[model samples]
Target: MAQIAFILLCHKDPEAIISQARQLTAAGDYMAIHFDARANPADFQRIQDALNDNPNVTFAKKRIKCGWGEWSLVQASLNAVEAALDAFPRATHFYMLSGDCMAIKSAEYAHALLDGEDVDYIESFDFFESDWIKTGFKEERLIYRHYLNERKHKKLFYASFRLQERLGLKRDIPSDIQVMIGSQWWCLRRRTVEWVMDFCRERKDVMRFFRSTWIPDETFFQTIVRHVVPDTEICTSTLTFLMFTDYGMPVTFYNDHYDLLLSQDFLFARKISPEATELKQRLGELYAAKGIEFQISNEGRSLFRFLTSRGRNGVRFAPRFWEAESSLGRERELLIVVAKKWHVAKRLASKIQEVTNIQAIEYLFDEASCPMPDLGGIQTQMGKRARHRRALMRMLYEYYDTDRMVICMDPKNMEMFQDFFTDRSITRLLEVESVFTDDYLAGHAIRVGLAGENTPSQSMERLLPTIRADVLGESDRIRDAGFERYYRISELRDAQDNAFALSQFLTIPQDEALQIAQTNHLFDD
Candidate 1:
């Protein structure tokens, strides 16, 4: 068996780190950990105590105070690698990991995989080629110097940096080394580690240059490997699964991601935070099912106990109303009215009821809005529009148990009521609109179309095809007729008289014009 040295740069979640260490420890595999100097002393000691009996596990003597986007992370990684190499001279492979990361595959499996492969597994791309650099603030990270830890004089530093940029005073990277950036996590061979260490030692200027740069850890290893190793010898995969939110923060995995994790062929996964105790429990169960032993620390167990207790008592607990049983019976069908004003919603709801004889609920977007029942004092930390829409959808699901067709539209576009109900039943209406102009129509249309298809007792895959065809056909017609610009009815309200004005713009028939006029009537009054 090939000896693999695992160098872990850990900060938070000591219990998780210890658990990972235990999992990676084996006869030929050695684990070297470098806990951040900023970590709690108690937590560090707990990890030490847990792994004291394991001879394969060791710790870096010179711990560094690692920070995000700082050079210290690179330094800590070097320290851990040096410690591992010194402790395990016969080791053939080196794997770098973080505290938040855990192995998805067994140590034996990992050894076998590495033994069969000759190339290094490191995700890398040319700095200039990546879209992130193109779309994101390029100069701030690449050209200008960022003093991430210099909090007290940050404003002064930023001002000076901007001044320098304006004056065209920019630092240049060493000509010999081309810039490459990638995920910090990587697996390499023993020869590669020696080569990197030697390169760093020989080129102090390169190290100095990277020290002043942002997120050096992401670039330092990648740049060196790309310069030294041939492209054929480098596999462009980190073999670790990491998920991030739209805002770029790492997403903590939960029970919801259980099947997703199983489906992936990654060796390790990251960012299973303390709040994800349930996820950890589920992972343990999954591993057990695969005939692999997984364990959680006492600290993790205690934290989960406290959280579950609080949840049971309804303290800081927000129930997903969408997943709950509906108090409204099957006899009563819901009418969701999406409007900006209460008066408009009320008028539209009354008008719809008069025309179709269906009882409806009005959901107003602006000032005169009424709160949904059973959701008092529950706060969602999402953006205003997303929170409101989520709450509305939850209420709709709770009240209507059946997987029936739903129609979503704006109260402002109440004129569409005649054309909308002319074909569909009144009970199928889910009146809602997007505050965002771009997704207003398409988002609601898809939501209503998918509403009852996923009900507990239904397996109608055919419904989605029909719904999709209808939506796509309408979209194509609007695009072909040059009415795509008028899709956002609210924006059109300011320029046009009524929905019929759209008919004039597109030069459609009178019946369609009348239909548009009816939907655009709220703005007319």
Candidate 2:
């Protein structure tokens, strides 16, 4: 099994770093921490002194006044790497981490997974084709020299950048090497690490070029790994789960995110907020515990990526219908509550799951919550609404980690999306006929052009069978006349009926389904 060594690049929160270092190295694994030069001297010394008793912990040789998108970060990392090589001779892998990061999974589990694998977990991609360097100089960022600190001296940096552009000054990359870029977090094997280190040291000319390249920390190792390690040995992905906003800012985890963070498949989660003391403590206890088994999953990662894609605007994605639905829904089963008025469906939406254990969710077509489409395009408005509705169902499908989901939708929406509800392979429809007397006025206001007075849709004594339709088979023959493919709220009045519907559609046992439904108070309300 490979022994994991951690390289932590931190600028603040010494106490947090000390805590993480101790937990990570508790198993005799090693850690090399690089503190920024500008950090409080007492903070840096505190971390060093705290880890001093541990033979496996070492600090970088020198501190660097690091700046965003600069080479100092890479140099500080190199110093730590050198210290680690000297201090922990037995470590077989080196993982790059940040100050706010914590172990979501135990170090032992990571070792077990990497036991028989010789692959390097580093995300590398063709610089130009990858299109990952968002909102910055494109390919020119690599080939152009950058000496100004963008974060520290914004005006000077921009002035220099503009001057360079005006003068058309560009540096030349060695033709033999292919430029690549990726996330800075990487877990490279001992051999790969040494090879990269040697290549970095020997390639003075290329090293000099990287020193002047913007954000060298992100591209330097990526380019080196691609050239030194064969493609077969490299896994183009990182071991850390670092979520980012649509604008590419890291998502800071809070105390409430404790369960969600650990449920991920990644060994580590980057950029944990220092203020999330409870989350850190929980993670520490989990990490310090021995022999805990965790199932590896890609869906957890995919699900989170799908979840975080949401922001102030809407669920971010290309303006395409198929991409919208599939990205949100994946292959999960659906339970849509189809009604004529929004309020009726939404009110019963909450109770459907309570009374039946069906995973009923709120409106899929949330007109109020979603933003209006850009001006002057009716098609855009219609298309955006449809995509939002379908995507919501798809997202719920994955979020609950089940194949099937139930949602409250409007009949107008169902008619608008006949293509979606008609898909027999993935959908299960449900209808709500009755509303609580107190809510009667609520649904009445959201009226459809029905009976002249348009009185309350239903009364306390009224119960209705599910809507029906004639389904046809081959030769245009009606296999079953007046046959509908949906369940009704009245039919699921008891546990037995609820269990049957949930069990049949969810593929779980009727009894177990009833237990889940009962636990959620599917009928108690």
Candidate 3:
């Protein structure tokens, strides 16, 4: 078995840290602890005393007064790594972790997984290409030098920084180095760790540049490692499960997150708090029941057996959809646009509001010939025939706060879409008729719909083919996509004719329909 070293950064809760160290302790393993210099010396001594009997446990001599979003945190981790390698010459791999982290997998499983791989498991993304830079706040953290500890003059400091940036006085990163960012926690081979340290030592300017950058701890190691290590030798996952709040802060894991944690294929989970003592105890019991031992004699043999057995079962647990659903809170209204003839739009809207009890609005593509009375729960909007349908969609989204919308060719098709609004339905359709604009937009909104009981897996099997029939002539493409599960409901099939009927009734020229369909990319493959 390859000797593994864990470099853990701890600042609080000595008891929890000790428990974590004990759980991970085994032969051919080393645990190096780095207590933050700001933490009480008495507490640090208590941790050291508790682990004094274990020869594998050691503490770093250089402790850093670490602060969030600061370089000191990186310094502390580097110190722990140095100590681990110096203390355990036999160590082959090193894992960086925080005190709040707990191992979800057994040490044997971890060793087996790592031993089979010769790559560094660190999540890294090019800074310029990352969504945080592309879609989120851009260059806010990079352009200005950050002093994380200067809280007293924060507003004035930022104001001055902004002034400097507006004047084109931005800080420049080294031309030789490319900035990369990732999760602070990572597991890497000893060689990669040594290379990163050496790179930082040789490039003092790069180190100095990162010291003033915001959240440098996330970028410093990843940038150095990605630059030094070959791309083939890097695995783009940190192998750590972290639950973050909407604001991007790691939330404390409690009893409620137990199933969520278990569903992930990660070895460790972080930010578990003292309040989660009961949860930790329960998890320990579950691990014991699963027969995951702390140590194994044959290297990689037990892990290979466990993995093969699991593969034979062919069952993978997906995170409960309700977890994401609950986070989204309330379900948004679905906007349906229907044909203007025979008051079909109003009737369909009223029926949907009555049956599903969901807030829905109907938009008439053509100007209403007469004043339509509001049907209490259902709302109506009329658009000029010359106006593009996408304009109406934008107006609905802007004025009504409608989160999801669908355009229908006819009102008779409304019954066929009732399942779309049903709580038991998947809410989003992977494939829909090309005429249906906002398919992706609606899918995103509904993907995080309100939380309740989960829909049965068979419900998706029944829903897709029924909707497929109404989608014109894409049957071959749909079937080839493996969506042909033969759920024949006559109501769904009959609705397919409504599009043609409404075309005739509205006297909509064939040329106009063809043009609209072409513009919407609704043509069958």
Candidate number with greatest lDDT: 2
Candidate 1 residue-pair clash tally:
5
- Report residue 370 deviation for candidate 1 (angstroms): 48
Name the lDDT of candidate 3.
0.59
lDDT of 2 at 168: 86
In order of lDDT, best first, we have 2, 1, 3
In lDDT terms, how accurate is model 2?
0.67
Compose the digit string of candidate 3's lDDT tens values, residues 1-525. Answer: 666789999899888888777767743468999999999999998998999999888888799998876778888988898888788888888988888887766666677888888999998889878764433434666767777554546687567777877898787778988888889889989899889888878988888788788777778888899999999999988888775544556767787555445545677888677788787876654432444533211112222232234223223344335422322113433333333122334444344344334344443443354333343312244433212233333354455454543333343332223323343212322222223333322332223231112322233233234333333323333334332121111122234443343233223455443332222212322
Model 3 TM-score, all chains together: 0.58
lDDT of each: 0.60, 0.67, 0.59
- Return the TM-score for each candidate structure: 0.56, 0.63, 0.58
- State the weakest 10-residue window (summed lDDT) of model 3: 483-492
Clashing pairs in 3: none
Per-residue CA lDDT of candidate 1, range 429-456, in tens? 2222213332333333234333221221
Worst 10 residues of 1 by lDDT: 294-303
lDDT of 1: 0.60
lDDT of model 3, residue 35: 94
For residues 1-525, could you state the per-residue lDDT of candidate 2 as single tens digits? 678889989988887888888888887678998999988999988887888998888888878888888999899988899888888889999999998888888767878868867899988999878978778677767766789898788899888878888898877788888889999999998898899889987999889888998888889899999999999999998989887766778888888766556556688888788888889998987766788865332233433453453232222334455632443333556666655445555555554465456666566364545333233333145455564545544444555656756665654332333445444436666544333343443333223211112222341112111111100111012111222455544323665765566555446666766664444433322
Ranking by TM-score: 2, 3, 1
Top-scoring candidate (TM-score): 2
